[model samples]
Target: MARTGFDIVRSTNNRGGVDDFIPFEATMRAARAAGLPVGDYIDEVMNGTPGATQSTIDRLRALGVFAANPNTVLEIGPGSGRYLEKTLKECDPGRYEIYETAAPWADYLVDTFKVVAQPTSECSLAPTPDGSVDLVHAHKVFNTVTFLSASRYFFEMARVTRPGGRIVFDVMTETCLDAATMHAWATKGGPGHDSYPAAMPRQACVDLFETLGCSLEAGFQAPMGFASTEVLVFGKGS
Candidate 1:
């Protein structure tokens, strides 16, 4: 049977369970219905603050990631296309590619942004030769999958990212789970609880990236009420 976008969502949630599931449009609707600050919900909750993509680009410029004029960029799981929408207008990367799990979003990204979009199942950048991409990134992806799975993806990211290229991603950590509300929710097993399964210690994630031949450049914690996230940037080694 040909799979639909909702099928993809169902399968992903099955694999990662309740914790990893993210229904982007539904989330937005819920947020709007609740009268929450949509920007804050999208940024702090969904990951990647407003202007985050551009700010990262600027930071990359400072770090020499863009020593060359044209940059090839790849991002995994660019949910809701918020970052892409802003980045396409703000920065002129030589080429842009996205790996998105939700089929509807994948089509939307291609139609809306005119960027190459691949299914999340095709996680590795096969057509993109090794060490070709200037920047490889994923936002709010690590904690959604098992750490083991995320590590595998990082290995692929390392392979495709050029020497001196940049990588950015976010992870939920044990410290995030220690938040009182989060701990209680985890215990209660209520709806919207345990929405992240693969929380790791921040140091552990940094160590993994370091072992993958990347050097941590900067990182910060964004406090979401249920689960905080650590946004990290790294520079790949030759």
Candidate 2:
């Protein structure tokens, strides 16, 4: 089968984003060349952390994100569907929707994971109805995108998740920005080459989610390219 992905245009200014297809295309090309899944290539070749994706899944499991047996789930920027595949194994959610701008990766996920790929606006979960999703999440996304974009998506996550539903995502929070980590981020120049090492205030994340009717339930460290990110889990109140 001819797998036609989106056209890859050179990203100007080293600006990295969810919609930028360059990373998606390049990762696929390398993965195919390496005889590995995108996730494996990322884990084995692209970082100081190996087995990063499964580690995140294990942590989420420990946090009870999988305990609810969520019937419906929505993920933002589920590139290559590593987390999506793991989450499906954990709970096998009946209605799994995804919003991804990399057309090829989105199509790959839809085919491989049997997930619904929603039309994406890059910063909103408009296709998902308010209070309809049992679990809404993103992985390794907030750490690369701009601050305003992550903030907008946070509001949208809260909007789509049902009362008592769960929200989970990772960001480069204060915990991830120690002096040594900052040095590594600057010098190591991880996979997110240009627009990366983005940081968000941890307190602000908890405080804003609280106002959005979700309370921070748990947070833990998850590995990104070369360093780590904080995955915050929130539970919506009834």
Off by over 4 Å in 2: 1-26, 190-193
- Across 102-135, the per-residue lDDT of candidate 2 in tens digits comes to 7777887888888999986758788788999999
Model 2 steric clash total = 0
Q: Which candidate is the best by lDDT?
A: 2
Compute the lDDT of residue 222 as modeled in candidate 1. 52
Per-prediction TM-score to the true structure, in the order listed: 0.72, 0.88
- Cα deviation of 104 in candidate 1 (Å)? 0.2
lDDT of 1 by residue, 196-215 (tens): 55676778768877988888
In candidate 1, what residue range of length 10 has the lowest lDDT sum?
1-10
* TM-score attained by model 1: 0.72
Each model's lDDT comes to 0.66, 0.83
